[model samples]
Target: MVWLTMFYLSSMIFLAFFSFFCLLSSFFSILFDVSYFIEWDILGINSNFLVMTLILDWMSLMFMSFVSFIASMVLFYSGGYMSGDVNINRFIYLVLAFVLSMIFLIISPNLVSILLGWDGLGLVSYVLVIYYQNEKSANAGMLTALSNRIGDVAILLAISIFGYYGGWNFYFYTDLIEEDSFKILVTLIILAAMTKSAQIPFSAWLPAAMAAPTPVSALVHSSTLVTAGVYLLIRFSAALEGSAAQTTLLLISSLTMFMAGLGANFEYDLKKIIALSTLSQLGVMMSILSLGYPNLAFFHLLSHALFKALLFMCAGAVIHNMKDYQDIRLMGSLVNQMPLTTFCLNLANLALCGMPFLAGFYSKDLILEIALMSSINMIIFFLYFIATGLTVCYTFRLIYYTLTGDYNLHSLSSVTDESYIMTSPMLSLGVGAIFGGALLSWLIFPTPYMICMSLFMKTLALSVSIMGGVLGYLFNFMVVNYSLNSLYFFNYIIYVGSMWFMPFLSTYPTSKSILVMGSMYTKVSDFGWSEFYGGQGIYKVSMSVSNSLQLVQNNSFKVYMLSFIIWVVMIYICI
Candidate 1:
């Protein structure tokens, strides 16, 4: 295990350097307007063939760099986080497998190879989600796997449709694809991306997946698994331009954002609040992408990854020191005990809230501004800003409960930031959280965005954010009797708190119907029809026939002589 830890750390260092080099290369390539495509023929029939294709454009390279960099930090953090686990080696391997799958997904331009990577992410994520091997972990893993499988099936369907284009290389046919055909393809791809990214109907799995270890949660929810869908759409953005798929994504993603924000405000679990925050941010990215700003969405994707990963690591540190206690109600005033960890946590939270100049600010502010400028429905327009306010609202609520409220834990509980391994990765990511957005913003968008909106609309984002902050403080910390669970709105609170009953809607009805049908089928086919027509029926019929035969055999002996004599007399008479 010690050797494995060292090996993983060394790999992280190498990955960091490689990521920097790739980012540099991508930066230069974009500056030079360079694009490269590489392909290798792997398998084929007479007319149909599978070719492994990879694109080395700025998008792929830059995204790959970010993925590698984050995975490296996660692996480093896991060293201290999983120190007590006996299967630490297995954990490391699974994380590596996850990173590799993400890399594959990142580089491929062909749907076929992307499917390979996509399915790999789903499989490896399930393994990681259930790594604890408990009932809770198992159930969470099942949900994660089943939900992602929906996306996998969608991709397969999209691939089948892409076969009409003579090849699965979507990059080549972005402009060549017929509008009608591209419409269907875009919808399939959006469905796939939606599930992977945990949008709307498929959103339950992201927070549920917190049953995994904290490090796994950090990695998966931040950059690898959940972002897979966003990245997929980024790659397919060209085909999706001017399509209805974008409108559909815009509507649902905005709702998802608002829903997750509302859910986070009601959630008490520390990690789950962060998980919901991730879900909300994912909606932001998807909505921006749907609004014809894939580049801006990609920028936010990278920026959000930096801060969100840091947020998770900070939460992991707090949870580790608090004796694995994750409930926010059980925690308070951590600034006195674990100053460094709390500092990182607060920084990440502020960044998540789109604080000015943080990683989230550069991208989030840009997104809101551009969203305001775009001529969208008034409802969606307001939902976008309201979602932004909700982000600040929940984050401030989280901060009040976790970092500023009175100490709520037992006096004996020891909390410290002495773990160098854990803090080192956290501090490293903390730097990224602070600066990664600015750096990536300049690199990704060499040209500044031109914005034109009314003064009131231009200031709406900040106004909402400030109002949310004030309300968050007043409701969460200042007020003593405010509760969403009060009799006034219990039902509404429950419905919103449960993420609009998405988890129940996705699981309960379908599961109940399947179970009922299965029971009926078992009774009718397995027990009733199978037994009667199969073993029992055969035995009964055979037994009856044998009994009659025996009776005949027993009576025939005595009667045979008389019968034979009668038959002979009748024949002679007739003759």
Candidate 2:
């Protein structure tokens, strides 16, 4: 225990120091408008160079700082959360390794080097997701791993394509590639990004991955794993400008945004709701990136990381105190029991809802305004606003269910806000959740984005947010004589509540057919025809021949002479 404490403290301090250093370096890089690319050539084959590359620019530095900072806090928080577990040390190391993978991913522009980090993130995350060693965690881990493998394959294919050129560094070759090759490369990269980011059809893994421990959830969902895709797209955004793939990404991301927000509104699992919210925010970032604003997407990514981490940590605290009960329906009036956690939770939720001046407001609101200004079709436009409203709706619903009602847990429940280790990290991140947005906006953008819209257009977001909040709260409110209205729309509720049956779609249909085919193959090949004609038939023929030869050998010269006389007699008779 003492060693574990020391390890956590030392790791936290180490990461914190580096985070500050990186932040300062990022500021300097931005101030000077400078970027440094360092490359080491490892090998050359047929004029194609295999090199390790590192990029030191404002973007990489800033993202590194945020990742490091959040990781430090999560590690600190885990010391308290996992203190009783025997394998705390293993958890800490895995998390640190996860952070290291993310760092490698942030700095490397070469596809070859990036795969080092990319695959590391996927492999480590699967291990972490299944850390609980349960069937659910195992299943979730498999889903997460398989979903991400698609992206890894895409990256590998991309590297192969880049090999046709002189180098694997996409930075140097993105614009130089011919149109046909560029489209193929861009499509591969988008497929990769989509899988990593958990866009529609690939999104089941994101919520399923919540089976991981909360600290891992806080890290993986917020900074390390999911954001890898968005970061990759941001790096490639220059090449992605004005392409057909970009339009497709816009449609997909918009649908993802809308789907996640709608699903969150109906979710009961507290962590799953938060996970859906993360998906929603990722959709926002991708959609804005698709609109050709990588900086804005990046801005939202950093800001979202802050509050989302806080949100997950707070959720962890609640789950921890509630004795691992994650159903929000069983939690109510938590403010009385754990005011500090409730406060931090509310702050994170409000920031998520894009409450004015909070971390989400600066980036999220700006994205909305800029998107409205862009010349997108009406479907994309409505999806954006409706999704925005859904964000607030689900948030308010979560707030109502978890914080503002009668204490719904048993009377003997021992929930308290006394753990300094846990609360301290929440407090530290609460500051970020509050001020990180304005600070990020000022630092990331030299000049504020110009807004020119009519009064009605300007107020639409605010109006929708207000309406959504009221409806979210009122809809969840209960009275003694109240009937179960949702039951009347049972099928509809189930359809919408279950992420539009996405979990089923992603898992059952494909797996069912594949599993059935495998069973068939096993029956026919292993037990039926192959057993009869392959192993059994070969063994029988070989054994029969061996027995005849053995009989002849046993009979020795007598049997040989008898057989020769029999053959001679048979020949004479034939003649």
Candidate 3:
């Protein structure tokens, strides 16, 4: 086990360095407007062909570098967090596989290879989510897997439709494909992206998947699984420009942002709050993508990956020392006890709120500014504003509840930054959270955004951010004796805190009918008809023949001979 851990750490460190070099090379490629596509004619069938295509551009390389870096940090952090587990090697192996799948998805520009990576992510994530071997993990894994299967089916449908183009690769023909002819394919692909990214209607799985180990959550929410959808959209943006599906995505993503932000404020579980925040950030990415700013969206995607990963590591550290207690209401006054972790947490949270100069600020603030300048509907504008505010609101609320209040846990509860393996990753990501935004902003966009909004619109982001902070502090700390015990409040709590019944809608109505039909089939066909025709009927017929044959044999030689003669006569008549 020690050797295994060392091997993983060494492998990740090597990969991280390799990715950094690749990133630098990609930047040069983008500088010269050089993009390369490598294709191999793997198989051909009649008029259709299956090609394995890889695209090397700034976007793919940069995103791949980020994924590799974050994954390396996660693997190092998991060594300490998962050290006590009996199946540590298994966990490490799965995480390695998860990273590989993300790499496959990152480079592929063809539908076939994308699906290969896409399904790999879904399958591996399901396994990771259920790693704990508990009922909750089981339920969460099922919901997660089943929810993502919708997207898988959608992508398969898209591949069938893309066959009309004579190949499954979109990068070569994305600009040439006519909007009218490929509208359905675009819509299906969008649906697949939404499912993978956990947009509205499929948003339930993101939070439920938090049942996995914290490192898995960090990877899934930060860079790999959820981001796959955003990356797909970025690749397919040319086909979707000005399409109805894109317009619909804008509305749905905005609503998703608002809903997730509100739900985070209502949630008490530490991991779920962070999970909801990821959902909201995903909404921000999708909304920007829908508005035809794929570059900005990709920038934010990279920036978010840094801080979110750090945030999860900090949360994992806190959870570790607190004996796995995840309820924020029960945590308090950790600044002195674990000052470094508290610092990391605060920095990551600030970054999440898009504080100026932080990683999130470069991407998030710019996104909001661009949205303000664009000619968008009033609803989307407000959704973007309110959702931005809610981001800060819930973040501040989380800070107050978990970091500054009185010590609320048992006397023996241990809280300290004693583990270097865990704290090292947090520190690494914290640096990125602070500096990554400026670096990526400059790298991705050499030309600054030119905006001409009025003063009021200019301060809209800052104004709402301040308001959200005040509201979060007031609501979580100042408000006391507020109860959800009453009938009305209880219902509202379920509706808001449970994400507007999305979990129920995604799981209950569909699962209930399917389970009922399954039970009916088991009783009627499997047990009843199958038992009779397959087992019981055969046994009864065999018994009857054996009994008659025994009676004929026992009667006597003469009787036996007569019976044989009669049987021969009957056979002759039948023949």
Tens digit of lDDT per residue, candidate 1, span 1-575?
56876787787788888889888889878889898899899888767678988889898888888888888888889889998998988888898889889989988989999999999999998998899889999988999999999999999998998888778988778885466877888889999999999998899899899999999999987889999999999888888778877898999999999999999988889999999999999999999899888899999999999989999999999999989999888899999999999899999999999899999999999999888778799999878888888889888888888889879989798888899989998898899999988998888887887888788887888999999998887786544425544767778878989998988887797679977899999999989989999999999999999997787689667678877889999999999
Question: Worst lDDT window (10 residues) for model 2?
Answer: 477-486
lDDT of each: 0.89, 0.93, 0.91
List the candidates ranked by TM-score, beginning with the highest: 2, 3, 1
Clashes of 1: 0
Which segments of model 2 are wrong by more than 4 Å?
478-482, 525-575
Best by TM-score: 2
Q: If both were scored by lDDT, which would come out higher, candidate 2 or candidate 3?
A: 2
Q: On residues 490-549, what C-alpha lDDT tens digit does candidate 3 reach at each position?
A: 777778999999998888887799888999999998899998998899999999999988
TM-score of each: 0.91, 0.93, 0.92
Candidate 1 lDDT score at position 434: 92
Highest lDDT: give the candidate number: 2
Tell how far residue 502 is off in model 3, in angstroms.
Answer: 1.3
Model 2 agreement with the true structure over 1-575: per-residue lDDT tens digits? 77777888999999999999999999999998999999998998889888889999999999999999999999989979998888988998999999999999999999999999999999999999999999999999999999999999999998888887778888877666447887798899999999999998899999999999999999988898999999999999988987899999999999999999999988889999999999999999999999999999999999999999999999999999999999998999999999999999999999999999999999988999999899999999999999999999999999989999767899899999999999999999999999999999999987877899999889999999999999888887655114776578889879988988988988897689988999999998999999999999999999999999989779688888999999999999999
Off by over 4 Å in 1: 176-179, 478-487, 526-575
Q: What is the lDDT, from 0 to 100, of the residue 367 in candidate 2?
A: 95
